[model samples]
Target: MPKMKTHKGAKGRVKVTARGKVVAYKTGKRHLNYKKSGKTIRLKGKKFVLFKGDARKFRVLLPYDWR
Candidate 1:
């Protein structure tokens, strides 16, 4: 069988923690920061856990991350 390729974009942005959960940075941090409220910007700094329902789908996209 051929080696499965990692979704390059997902690989770059998402991380699998030691416990095997998928985590990714919150969106909306790339532009127009000046107009955003301080709290909104702060929240964007944190990593978010992908929901189980959604993770099931994302898992397929990130086939290289073996459990």
Candidate 2:
């Protein structure tokens, strides 16, 4: 069988944690942030785990990252 290729974009945007959860940075903070609330900006800086449904899809993209 041929080796499966990892989705480069997904690999860069999401990460597999030690416990096997998929974590990713929040979006919507790149531009026009000056108008956003301080709390919103702060919250966007943190990494959040993907929901079970989303994580399952990402797991397929990151075939080699079985962490």
* Per-model tally of clashing residue pairs: 0, 0
- For model 2 the local lDDT of residue 64 reads 93
lDDT on C-alpha atoms for all candidate structures:
0.85, 0.94
Q: Which pairs, if any, clash in model 1?
A: none
Compared with the true structure, what per-residue lDDT tens digits does model 2 show for residues 1-67? 9999999999999999989999999999899999999999999999999999999999889999976
Expressed as tens digits, the lDDT of each residue in 5-67 for candidate 1 is 778887888888878798999999999999999999999999999899877777887986747
Candidate 2: segments with Cα more than 4 A from true spot: none
For model 1, the stretches where C-alpha displacement exceeds 4 angstroms are none
lDDT of 2 at 9: 98
Listing every candidate in turn, what is its Cα RMSD in Å to the true structure after a full C-alpha superposition? 1.3, 0.8
TM-scores for all candidates: the values are 0.85, 0.94
lDDT of model 2 at position 1: 100
Clashes of 1: 0
